[model samples]
Structure formats: C-alpha cells, structure tokens
Target: MAWTVPGLLAVVLVAALLTAMARGYALRRQLLDQPGERRSHAVATPRGGGIAIVVSQLLAYIGVGVLFPQAAATLAIFSAGLVMVAGIGWWDDHRPLPALPRLGVHVLAGLLLGALVWHWTGEASSAGFSVLLAIALINVWNFMDGIDGLAATQALLASVAYALLLPAPVAGLALILAAGVLGFLPFNFPKARIFMGDVGSGALGYLLAGLVALGLGTRSAPWTILLVPLAAFLVDAGLTLAGRVFRGERWMEAHTQHLYQRWVKSGCSHVMVTSGYALFGVAGIVLMHVFTWLPSPWSHLAALAWAAAAAGLWSVLLNKVHR
Candidate 1:
C-alpha cells in the first residue's frame, strides 16, 4: 500500500513514454485518420497511440503475476483475452477490417473474461454480466472516443472510483490504470497529439470489465454501485444506438450522432463537453461512496434513481443541442 503512489507514478511515466513512442510509430507508418463528415476532429492525426496504454497495462499484469504466482493462471487468461481485443484493434487501425470479424474477436475475448468472472465468483449470472459488459464496453468506448479526452478521461475517473471500492490488489490495479490514462491524457486533452485508436479504446473497455468482474467476485460492493461510474457513457451510447436502430439506420456505421458529438457540433468546444461529462463522473463517485453506507435495497434504489436522472438530463441536453 505504501508503494502505491510510487508504483502509479512509475506506470504513468512508462505509459507516457510508450505513448510518445507509439505516436512516432504511427507517423512513421503513415497511419493517419483523416477528418471527415462523420468524424469529430478537424485535422488528420496519427491513431493507435493507445498501444502505449495496452503495453503499459500488460506489463503491469506481468508484474502482478510475478508478485502473486498463485494468481498467475487467471491473470494469464485475462491477459490472453486482452491481447485478442487489442490485437484486432491494432490490426484494424493499420488496415480496415470488416465489423463481423472484429466483433467475433471481441466476443471471444468477452467469453474469456466471462470465464474469469465465473472462476472468481462461481456465479453464472455474474459471468454472463461480464461477457455482456466486455462486449458493450469495448464498442461503447470506441463509439464515445470520437473526441479528444472524452474516452480516456472517463476511464481514468471510473478506474479511480473502482479503486476506492475494491480490495487492495485489484484496487492497486485500478489505480495503475488511472495512472496510465493520466500519463496519456496530457498528449490527448485540450489538444490532440494522437488519437487512442481502436486498439486503446477497445482494450480499455475490456480492462474495465475485468475490474468490474473482480469487484463482483470479491463482493467489494453492490453490483449496482459498480454500475454508477459507467452511467454517463452507457446512457449516451445506448440511446444513440437505439435511436439509430429505431430509425432503421445502419446502427454500426460510424457517425457523430452521440450526445457528446452533437454537443460539439452545436458550437460547444470539446473541453466544455468533456468537462460537463466529467462533472457527472465526479458526482457518480460521490454517489458511490454514499451508496456504500446505505442499506442494500436502498442503495440499489438510489443507483437506479441516479441513473434515471442521468437519462433525463441526457434527453434534455440532446433536445436542446439538436435545435
């Protein structure tokens, strides 16, 4: 525990260094994402800077495996799944891949993570939830990552929230995740040096699912509390997807239809939208701590209430900005 701050700093440094290197690699390889009508950014930028975060987190997993040999097998399984998700994403970033094959790899990775959840808690329900969480988060993150700072910043805040709720080992892992994102944030936020790419965003979702699975397995807190930190993104991404589907649109097609994207298009700066979402995240953290102290049914009720409030706010904002 005493070494946590130092360890976090070390990982942050490693992630920053790795991100810088990833940027160079992308530029050298001419892996550029051009600005487009369906896109958010205004200029061409090197993608896949997320490889740095993936590499940094994988190294952290290795260190954990070495320190706790008993946990190595499970960590190995988790790492394998992580590789699948990141691997597909990395490949896609270099050469565009069809959605079905990419979804297939994501499903496989989700199953692997689901098995880890089952192994941890022996609960089929929890395992099922992990699978869905993995798949949902992977794509949700990818969809929401349209703007500078939104995806990574949300992840950093959520990881910090989970770290506070989980036990020591997993908590430390969460902190390390937050630190790695922190390291990447400087290069991303306020201005874009390099995008997180599919590699980073998908892997990030899987990594968060891993944390949620561990938290559920350990009974660190109520499952509802675990959902709090993710409320904002789920609301935006879920509603946007549903809207597209209801309108008989190609739901999976890349588009700037998300609430955050609309906000950006409505003349609000990326900083404003990101900061607004962050306020909700900070509120979620505060609510998580409050939910911890409440009785069981009440805590669950409060989480639902907060989520409803979030959805309501999202609707109001969406209508306002759509005008």
Candidate 2:
C-alpha cells in the first residue's frame, strides 16, 4: 500500500463533496424527511446524503482492486453486494419501498457476502455467520440512524476499530470507510444539515458486515474480538427490535422506541445522547484491543462479558426511561 494515505484522503474529500451535492439535490427535488411522531428530529431536513458515502466506498474498492489486482475478484464480489444493498436503500429514500422487498434485496446481498467470505476463508461456518451478520447490520444501522451523529459516529468508531484489529486489504478497506464517515459526520452532527437517509445507513451496515466477514476470513483476530466494537449498536437495535416483534407489532415499521430515542424523549439533547453512544463505542474499541492481548478463552469470555453488560444496560434503560 503505497496508496494508503492518498486513498484515505481521496475518500474523505469525495465523501464530503458528494454529501454536499446530495444535500443540494435532495433540497431541489424536495426529498425531505419531515418531523412526525415516528421521527426524532423536529425540523424537515434534506436526506439521501448517504449516497455520498456509498459512492465514496465504491470508489475506494475500485482503487484497491486496481492497485492490487490479485484482490480484484474479492473486491468485485464485495462491490456487487454493496450495490445491491445501497441500490434498494437509494430507491427507498427517493420513493419509500415496502419492507419485504427491501429485505429480499438485503438477503440476496447477504448471500453474496456469505459466498465471498466462504471463498476467502474456505469455512462454512464463517459463510453462514456472514450471511446473518449482513442482514442483521443492514437493518440495525437503519434502526439506529434516528438521531443526529449517533449512526455516523458509531460507524466511524467501528471501522477504525476494525482497521486496528484486521490485517491488510481488509484493514485498509476499514480505514477508508472511517475516513469517509469522518468527512460525512460534520454535516450531520450538532445540527444536522442533511441526513444519511436509508441509502447511507443500510449501505454502512452492509459495509461493516463486509469488514467483519473479511476479518473473519483473514483470521486477523479472534472472531469474538472482532464483534466487540459493534456491541452497543447491536444491543440497542436487537433488543428494541426483539421487544417489538414479541409484542406482535409491525416490527418493520419505524418508531421511536429505541433507548436512544427514549433518552432524547426524556429530555437529553441529540449531542448528549450521541456523545454517550460514542463513549460506549470508544470503550468497546479499547476493550477489543485489550482482549487481543489476552489468551483465547479469556479474550472470548471478556467479549461475552461486555455483551452481557450491554444487555443489562439495555434492561436498565428501559426500566428507567418513560415513553
């Protein structure tokens, strides 16, 4: 990687520039998300800005493929899956699509990712897990994208953490994503000028899942440690979704039932809630790195402990916060 520094810089610049362009297009086209009961923001805002991140990431992949021709097949597969996820999301952002159809596309993309990982690692279990993880994250990030800075910051932290934990190629991919998210964060945080929309959120989740799969494939670190960075978002999104489904509600529909949403409804600012999640993300990243130094059973056990603690916190938050 002689192109490492240049790739990162290019991604950041492209992401920022594309986000601005997307925002302008959204505004001109009147593609805005207006405040309502289901939404967290108070004002109508331009969306579809996440297309910037998607485009930037695709470019990064192409760049990598061009530089390292040996990785071209893997990158092509990865890029196809990404386009599938991002394409459906991009459509939904423009003209809302039904949940099942979007989900079908996600499943298809998941299978593609599963195959890619299977090819990389020659492991059936990793392939299976990759499928599940891709589907799970594609929706989780969308679910957690309700508040300002929350989704983007979590992505930034998770990608950077993966970059540190994984080996080359995959590690480089993760860093490029982190740089892209870093460029997109300012427009969305403190005061959101534009939203990532479905396009950005779902694509991000897909990319994160892709990175996790690559890490597993490369055997860069223990599988358990690779998952530690995503604990907070997963716990929040998973438990909230589980609770919804258990109650026989239309779980696919958007609502403000997440703990982060409840905290905001309970009078916390977006910055406060977002920053709090960032701290959890930072803590998880540190813990994962720490676990890398520990032995097998201990590292795995420690990761499980972190997840358990997150689940406990989820329970506690639900008890303390009133809708």
Candidate 3:
C-alpha cells in the first residue's frame, strides 16, 4: 500500500487516459456546458470529464484496501459515499434536477460520510458537525467550479497538502486523489476541452471532506489546520452567500459574484485566477505546517494572524472588482 514512484506514475497515466476517453465520450453525447451570463467560458465545452478522476481514485482505494485488508471496512464506507454523491451528480448533469432533491441527496451522502468518520474516531458528536461540513463543502465546491481548471487545481493542491499531513492509509488515498486531479487538469487548464460537470465537482468536495475528517480522527494537530488550506474557497463562498442574503437576492441562484468569478470578470484569464488561488492554497499549507511546530499559545496566535491576513486579502481583492 506504500505509494512508490512507480505506483504514482501508473495511477496518473491511467487517470489521464481515462479522462481523455471520457472527454471523447462527452463530446459524442453532446454533454456540453454552454456560454451564459453566469458562466465564465465563452464557447461550449464537453463536461462530465471528472468521471475519470472519480473512477481512478475509487479503483486506487479498492486496490489499496485489498492489499491491506485491515483498511477494507473504512475504504468500503468511503467508496459507498463517493458512489452515492457521484451517481446523484451524474444524474443531475444529464437531466436537471430540482434544487431540493439534489440538496437532499447531498445531505444523505454527507450523513454516510459522517458515519464513516464516526466509526473511525468513535466520537458520535463529531458526526453531526462532519455531516454539515461535508454538505457545505460539496455545495461550495460546486459554486466555485464556474471557471476552467479552478476546482481541479484547488483539489489537487489540497489533496497533496493532506497527503503530507496525514498518516499512511489516509495519506495514500490523498496521494491517489491528487494524482487523479492532476490527470484531469491537462484537459481543463488554460483552455477547456471538457468540464468536470456536477458529478466531478460534488464528488471532489465529498472526497476532501472525508480526508479532513480522517485527518482529524488520526492526527493530533489543532483543528485549525483542517480549515487553513480551505480558507480561500470558504471565505469567497461564505461571504458571497451572506452578501446575497443581505441584499435580498436569491443566494442559491447561480451568479458571478465569487471573488474568483469577479476576478475573471475583471479581465483576468482563467489560468491567471486559478494560479492565484493555487498560490493561496500553498500559503495556507505552509502556514499550517509552521503552526504545528510552534508552542500551543503561539500556534493559536499564528492561526488568528493568518485568519486576519486572509480576510484583509479578500477585502482587497473584492475592492479590485467593479460590481
């Protein structure tokens, strides 16, 4: 189950091939995302290419579980939740579903994922929190997937960070997920050949939530570590939702109000915006790691300082975008 260089390379190659094939299939099936007022891209592009990432990561998990029988139950639970989310997303992708029904499916999948975390950590109270976190992450990730390559790039960076922070089995899963996203990136970055669709975005959010839970269950680090790398997405989405409610707008309706969206609207290319977010993610990872090496009080102070800095940066970025 140890991820050797050869194993990583193999996973990446397989995922890339699968993604390319999925792109072709998507084009043939006319699964395209069309240009719109809320959309960032101009031309129609094939979507649902994220299926490749989902399949690749799931297969890697199964392989790892088989090789290490002790981890099979946990892996099975994770896989089951992933399948549920991905299935619902795929269904939504092909045929539009009511918001309530899609939300319900997301809640169910979140509960399943929460239960998996509870089983691992033996903390029933944390399950509720985990469920809420999972649901929120799924929706937030979906909201941020408006631009080409942004979600995939963020997922890749977060996955790699998790792999570095977690222990063996969980780290192995994170590594595979990182590879899977990397495989999908070539088709998505700069110019899009295909989109990840709802299927990929929702499932990725679920996967990251699961990883965060696993990290909490196994590691002794401050819980803030879990939130650090995700601060960028959380802040942008959270603030936008709050602002919408304040303005009496339909917060749930699709719009180009997110910081990243605004940046794109400000004339930055998709690649430029995505790279900026990736850098933010890296800063978070570095800060989280540095905090771990500090004394308890110092670590708390550092976390607060980072939070303030992030808020200030967000404010500055928002000001740059003409509403």
Judging by TM-score against the true structure, name the best candidate: 1
Q: Which lDDT value does model 1 have at 33?
A: 92
Error of 1 at 312 (Å): 0.3
Per-candidate TM-score against the hidden true structure: 0.98, 0.97, 0.96
Q: Where does candidate 1 have its weakest 10-residue lDDT segment?
A: 1-10
At residue 82, candidate 3 shows an lDDT of 86
lDDT of 3 by residue, 123-229 (tens): 88678778988899889899999898899988998888888888875687788889889888999987889899999999999999988887778864666767777
Q: Give the TM-score of candidate 3.
A: 0.96
RMSD (Å) per prediction: 1.0, 1.2, 1.5
Local lDDT at 109 for model 2: 96
RMSD of 2: 1.2
- Candidate 1: misplaced stretches above 4 Å? none
Question: Which model, 1 or 3, shows the larger lDDT?
Answer: 1
Clashing pairs in model 3, backbone N/Cα/C closer than 3 A: none
Report the C-alpha lDDT of model 1 over 8-89, residue by residue, as the tens digit.
7888999999999999998999999999999888999999999889888888878878888998899899999999999999
lDDT value, residue 161 of candidate 2: 93
Q: What is the C-alpha lDDT of each candidate?
A: 0.92, 0.92, 0.86
Name the weakest run of 10 consecutive residues (lDDT summed) in model 3: 1-10
Find the number of clashing residue pairs for candidate 1: 0
Q: Which pairs of residues clash in candidate 1, taking residues 3 or more apart in a chain or in different chains?
A: none
